[model samples]
Target: MKLDALGMAQSTLVFVVLGLTLLAFMWGRFRYDLVALAALLGSVMLGLVPAEAAFNGFGHPAVITVVAVLVLSRGFERAGVVDLIADQVLKVGERLLLQLTVLVGTVVVLSGVMNNVGALALLLPVAMRLSREHNTSPSLLLMPLAFGSLLGGLTTLIGTPPNIIISSYRGDVVGENFSMFSFFPVGASVALAGLLFIVLVGWRLTPHRAGQATAEDMFDTANYLVELRVDEEAKAKGLTLQQLQDELDETIPVLAVVRDDKRSAGYAFYDALQEGDILLLEAGPDELKVLEDKVGLSVVVTPEEDDDSSTIEKQPEHKKDGNNKDDDDSPARQVDTEGLQLVEAVVRTDSMMVNRSVRQLRLHHQFGLHLVAVARDGARLKQRLRDIRFQGGDVLLFQGGENEISESLATLGCLPLAKRELNLGQPRKLFFSMAIFALAIIAMLLDILPTAVALSTAALVSLLVGVLPLREAYQAIDGPVIVLLGTMIPVGQALETSGGAALIADTLLHFGSKWPIVMTLTGLFILSMVLSNVVNNAAAAVLMAPIAASLAEGFDASLDPFLMVVAVSASCAFLTPIGHQSNTLVLGPGGYRFGDFWKLGLPLSMVVMVVAIPMILWVWPL
Candidate 1:
């Protein structure tokens, strides 16, 4: 491709726009979709990209395939695939090495057939339980699991967004996309090598993280749990458990009811409260005061909370300032403590609670649940309950009815870190999920349908057959991710069509061509891997694939090996938490600091690069 004066000017403009787009991505201040859109609009305005093609990327095969894969990943979850497989992991016993192997291996296999992040989401809590059970730091297991998901993504087309995007670019190049299992030969080899290193050696390289010393520290019940006596004139006297929450502008969970000297809580939310009914509440001193004055409830002091070390010991003395001393002097209340379940759950990347405060969740009003304590990065949050904003991977301690806890966690988009707490899934849906997935693979293998068409049709069949509800299917589609892909595709084309990629290729070859071809390939892999650590992997692939193709031409080498190198290396985002969602998902729960990933990830990256270059050359044959 030749460039005249105007075309050269346009190439410079594309370079400027892409530089700024990359900065914005690494800055982490703005959402990626917004950044990608800005880049596309800039390219069009600068005459680097045609204005007519601005919206065409939305209808691209890559965008559709990403959407369909997301929905299908959710369908598999709703069908108990993870639950069924997770039950098997618990049987791995307490041997740390054996546990790590099975844990990383399970996520690896699951990642090959489903979205890598989705597969990680299903297994993360299981990994947490293993950490808790073995009495080891979550840091040991989490980072490897995150890295394993990235490795597993290399094994299949739909495993990660980057693979799908790479395949689309390949389709545009040769008029045919890579086959469904084309990645398996190279990807599986790299994955198995990476998985073994993580299980056997890399896990020991993780930073020492010390927090949440025991499971008891997970639930904050010392001062928060209390007994409230309802009077005849109380606002809660006539209302059912849920109704009381509905009426209050500021509500606290009524943990249980004490009636006629005995406690009864079954159907508590549906039953109406009566006079003299004592309600067990999870509230702070401020909320307790609000209930005492506004709801006409009285606090009953129990014999030193449930624990001797409880900070609630001084609560009775603090409230002894006078008028209500008679109630304080009454015999210590015998509170019934049955059927209440306190469970720990992690906030997921897709959770609605992300960036939302406890006051905003309205969990009690909606799900009859109480937020007892929250731990992030392996330590309990010290901020006020309402001031605490949630982030992905934050561990939360919730107190609710035994049966209601499971439903509430699913509704709140949090995964319980407890054992065998997978969603209540039907066996029939499990069959449906697996069967539909197999059929999609068959369709692609036989070339009866294209990868995008086959997977989209399978996703549609899952919805029609009720593998997942219609509402959930819609929720499964990540709008921001889809938008980022659709908008960035055209901007990426502007980089190629505008001669910007040719300019970059010339600069790269000028300095890099003195080395052997293997050295050049190694540099490309290293550059792509480093770029992936700083930005979204899909975006890295989007920006690099064109430059990669251009570089292959400059070297007079076949494009398959170069493309394969880009595909595999772009998913090697092991050096940082922000590199991928799977890494981000393990951030808070693993108690890792910003600088922590490189400890394990640096060696792991070198391993992947060493193993991957030879594998790619041998398999794809440059």
Candidate 2:
């Protein structure tokens, strides 16, 4: 195919636009969506993408496919499908390795059938709960789960972004769509090998951290510590020390005792009595209030050197002054008069706060929220308080006095980043959610309608039926990702229209001429994997699918094997969470170190390459 001047110009423009987008992603100079939109506008100005075709990707079958998958995945979550599967799989707890085998295997199986990210999302909380109950770090279960999710995506056409892109490209190339299980054999083989490696060797690679140190110990909160003096009217003034256990109101922990300026050791019990005795506690606002209210005591949060500590010690002498005036002047009383509550939240992988310190974000200054401590994986972090950068899945122990920090959370653009303290099966707006999603998937799969139409219908039904409130359902769909997909789809179509794919195909074939078709196929698979890791999987797949199709045409080889290679490889995002949204989602909560992904993922990637190559050759024939 000879390139026309227009085709050459458009191709050059595509590279420029892509370069800008990548620069923006790496530089953190603008929102990703803004970058994508700017690229789209630039493409139009350069005449690379036709004005009419610019918005077509928004309605493209591929875009619809992802949206439908996300909604359907949510529906399955509401139905307890994941929990049900986990319950059966997690029961093999006696042998730790065997349990991991079951857990990884089950997730892989589920990922094959559903959207892999949704599958992981559904299973992650369950894994965390199991870890907590079993006294194990969530780190052990999460890496395997992430790997399994990636593996599972290889088994189905709609399971991951790459598969759907490859399938659509094949339809345009060979006049046929791939069957749902077209990539199953190749995907399954790799999944099996990956599962074996994870169960046997992967977990041993993680860093070891001791279990469950109190927040005070972890953050060295002694700097924030102070003494509280019990007054004659206080309820705790007459109670035994044993009455106060490890926790106050199931939140704060009581640390130690101080009396007459002297500190006592050894845990005190309910039989100990005191007046003018001092107590040391580890807590933020909410728990502190509960301690004051439940025990009929007052809080003394400031350090001993502060006025409250000195004045409380001299309170007997202060009785000579009017008591009401003294009470009104107390700092503790003033603090209580101001409503404040502390909240514990996590930084989600999708959040913008990744790799930024709280001090940089000016969390307290701008958000009216103070960061107390950050927990990652199972380890309580001890970093320079002002210098510690927040990553996705970093559990933030923060102080938020009311307002729910709603505006701050939005401005930060991070996921709640914290797992809600709710039971897995606790009922909350589930019935309606399940029905809407089920109807959408069934409608599309049965060919009763186009997928986008069916999903749009369901989105409306969900809203009307009150299965999903308007605000929440809208928020569920990530607009930035949607816009990126929508804008890129048109550019991909232009590449097809302009014969740019043929040029890429010719260039690759010149180098690959001596290679067997299967060898060439492997080369394409490896290229897709490399591109997927460096760029967003969806964007890489969209660009590479056309080129893969063009190469198959150039060789007069069957398109299925070539497409299968792309499908399997594109979904195999194993090196980093940034490669895929699902990986990012689990990063902070799973407490995964950046390097931890490749510990299990590298072996898995190798397995996929080895297994997928042969399976593609055998299953579809080159």
Clashes of each: 0, 11
lDDT of 1 by residue, 373-472 (tens): 7887767665556778788778887777777888788777787776656665888898889999999999999999998899999999999999988888
List model 2 lDDT by residue over 1-622, tens digit each. 3343566656656666767777776565565567777877877877777787778778777677777666656555544556667677656764667767777888888887667876776677566556655666666777778778888787776678777777666666666656556667777777787777778887676544334323322333433333456767777766655444322324233334667665543132223647777765444444445566777556554443355545544432332221334354444333321122334455654466777766567665577665656666645564434567776566666655455565576456554433333334434446666666667667756768654567667767756765544555545565666777888777676666666777778988998998877777878888888777756777778877888888988999877777777777887788876677667666665656778777667777887788778877887887
Q: What is the lDDT of residue 180 in candidate 2?
A: 59
Candidate 2: which stretches are off by over 4 Å?
A: 1-8, 26-31, 86-94, 174-176, 206-344, 352-371, 375-391, 399-446, 454-466
TM-score of each: 0.85, 0.72
**C-alpha lDDT (0 to 100) for residue 546 of candidate 2:** 83
Model 1 alpha-carbon drift over 4 Å, by segment: 1-8, 45-47, 208-215, 222-224, 228-279, 283-299, 303-338, 366-369, 399-412, 422-432
Of the candidates shown, which would achieve the greatest TM-score relative to the real structure? 1
lDDT of 1: 0.80
